[model samples]
Target: MPTIASSNFPTPKSWDEFEDICLSVIKVKCKSTNFNRYGRAGQKQNGVDITGKDHFGFSIGVQCKNTLNLLTEKIIEDEIVKAESFAPRLSTLYIATTRPPDAPLQSFIQKI
Candidate 1:
């Protein structure tokens, strides 16, 4: 597989900035302008950083992970567990991360 051009874009300086970027991208891709940041800092967010209905009018949740290293299965699983409680019952959950495309990780996520 071709490698991702990580140098093509600037990494976010903080978690908040990362989430903001993810929010913007989701808005454009999903064609929905009603999304908002899910929760304040230091609060339980049910694993969602940004959320709202998508273009299909389905409830969507996004979790922005700003980790520099690879995302562990445990981390993903834990977040999914938390997200299970999000109200309105999210029709879809997106895990947006800075981590590169790892085949194993991708496989694991796909199985979910």
Candidate 2:
């Protein structure tokens, strides 16, 4: 993971804050990165929080969440579908959250 320098603490208080943090990390990790939100600060993000190209030129889409709760199967499924719709097409989809995925979620991610 890339190091993120922020004025705010690591624990983001809002979803937008979490997204910003994820963007920062992505910017450091990828060859190039873009925050995909438009309109107001809390507007719908159209599924992607950050998009970038890795060092190897693979496109990636990232969705950020600031929840302590486990990511439910339904939620992951929905996010996966959303990521598939991202423009320019992504070679990889990553969910950036403070809490790590549980065993089943980890397995699901690995399989995908």
Per-prediction tally of clashes: 0, 0
Q: Where does model 1 exceed 4 Å of error? A: 1-7
lDDT of each: 0.90, 0.72
Error of 1 at 48 (Å): 0.7
TM-score of each model, in listed order: 0.91, 0.73
Q: Flag regions of model 2 displaced more than 4 Å.
A: 1-10, 33-44
For candidate 2, give the lDDT of residue 62: 85
Q: Which of the numbered candidates is closest to the native, going by highest lDDT?
A: 1
Maximum-TM-score candidate: 1
Q: Write the per-residue lDDT of candidate 2 for residues 1-112, one digit (tens) a residue.
A: 4453433345678877887778787877775654443335575655677776787788888877788786677788888887777777888877888775488777877776
